[model samples]
Target: MALTIMIADDHPAVLYGLRRLLENAPRSRFVIADAVEGGQALLRSLRGRDCDLALVDWYMPPERGPSGRELLARLRTTFPQTTLVVMTASQQPAVLAASLAAGATGLYDKRECSSQLPRILYQAAQGRLCVSPSLEIVLERHYLTRYHWGQENHQALTPREREVMRLIAAGYTGRETAAQLKRSEKTISRQRRSALDKLGLNPDSVPTLAPG
Candidate 1:
């Protein structure tokens, strides 16, 4: 039997192109689903659709506005057996590293969609890691930087603190952040203050925290 595959992307053009690519492949059976955002894709996959691979958009609007990392972490935990492949245009080292750390089996640069995808998908299906060469270079540099930065620097923030920082960076007001984090407004305020103080990130500084 051929492997089952699912593609989750927000852009209509990318979705159409991906469909054409998969449909033309000669070796595997693929199941494709279109979702405007990440949550819906997770919902459909969790319904026991039995996909062997999932090609997820690197960024998507969250269902309830949760961070993309949180959503990806949830999906990874819930669907441990499915091979998750990130298909995104983001070539930033930090972005690629985060996706791989979030349990993606492979990271395919969207620019490589024309010819590289089929081989990457096939490799991922066989339990091998796949990542764009550009991303690999970034990952290597990131690894070296971390080695120099020491584990202590990396351990500075708790997961919750990071989440709070991310939400704030996303432009969520205190009240909105409180609701999203499921905490009292006062608690959210405190968390934000603490994160800002630690990161030396000025509360007034504007940061575009891109999803995931």
Candidate 2:
């Protein structure tokens, strides 16, 4: 049976291109069930009809509705049976990591869509996790940096400090990290300072410690 797909992107050209791409992918059994231009339209379409997969753009205009991990998360919760493949032009490893953490089954870089999207869709239809090569490299560096930080400072910091550092390295603001860890922002800031000092990292240079 052919896999049915729903596409959601804020750009009309992207919607048209994706629809055409999936419809014409050689040897692939895919059907374009619906193509919509924003999150609201996508949700409306999905409520009225089910599809085997959904391809969503990671960033869309704020007026269109939620974007990024929030959009992926909503789709995952509301339509658990539909496989989600997120498309992004962002090079930030944190964005890619957050998408997977939010339940995306596949990550496709917009730059490689014409060459790699078909295989990504096929793998996602099979329920396999797929990460584009470029995106994978970014994530790999993120992990390696965290590993190095651990190796160098594991004994120097307490567990809470380590946890705070990890979240900070993953792009969370101090306040967001505090909310996630259920601590006060002041406490999070203090822990972050301690962790950075122990790691011999300047707070101003934290962004350089992780891949963006």
Candidate 3:
């Protein structure tokens, strides 16, 4: 059966590019069911509908649309059977980890593309957790940490702390987060420590996404 795919991104260029990539490839294997520009529309149009896969942008800016984390979780619930593949421009470890925790079956960095994208999308439709190639090592390390150390208390951290923690979990050192956030290493460390402290986990250990 040809895969039924939906593309959702806030940018016209991105949505167009993804549509073109999937439908115009030399041996296109997917059937473009519909292309939506915003998260809200994507969710609304897809609810109660059966689609094999959905490629969603990590960030969608419309006011009525759910963005980032909420968007991923919502999609998982709203369209339980639809495999979700989050698209992003960054290979940040935390983003990759969090997406999987939130039920994303695939994570694709927009900077990375081509035939591999379709392969992962297909894997996702088959119930596998897929991530960008460059991110696999980072994912292997933090994939456990995201579930064990951070998820339960994720709601406790400040926005800044969450940002710092995601990078740290992604295998980025404090220096990396500092440079990425344009802040001092001390500030990044403090934010990461604060988030970890709030979550009651030690940075030295890796845990599952849901502790039972």
Q: Where does the lowest 10-residue lDDT sum fall in candidate 2? A: 144-153
Best by lDDT: 2
Error of 2 at 138 (Å): 0.8
Assess every candidate by TM-score: 0.63, 0.71, 0.67
What does candidate 1's lDDT look like per residue over 59-169, in tens digits?
877652333466568778878888888887886655776776677778888875467787788888888887777666655554444232112232577788888878866
Query: What residue pairs clash in candidate 1, if any at all?
Result: none
Query: Which 10-residue window of candidate 3 scores lowest in summed lDDT?
Result: 203-212
| lDDT rank order | 2, 3, 1
lDDT of candidates 1 onward, in order: 0.67, 0.79, 0.74
lDDT of 2 by residue, 1-212 (tens): 89989999998998898888878878868889899888888887899577899999989887888888778888998999999999999977557767777778889999874769988888988998887888877765555443332133557999999898888778887667878899988888788777767755545646522221
Residue-pair clashes per candidate, as listed?
A: 0, 0, 4
Residue 180, candidate 2: how far off, in angstroms?
22
- Relative to the unseen true structure, what is the C-alpha lDDT of residue 157 in candidate 2, on a scale of 0 to 100? 93
Instruction: Give the better candidate number (2 or 3) by TM-score.
Output: 2
**Local error of candidate 1 at 155, Å?**
2.4
Q: How high a TM-score does candidate 1 get?
A: 0.63
Which candidate, 2 or 3, has the higher lDDT?
2
Our model 1 lands, by Cα RMSD against the true structure, at 10.0
- Which structure among the candidates has the greatest TM-score? 2
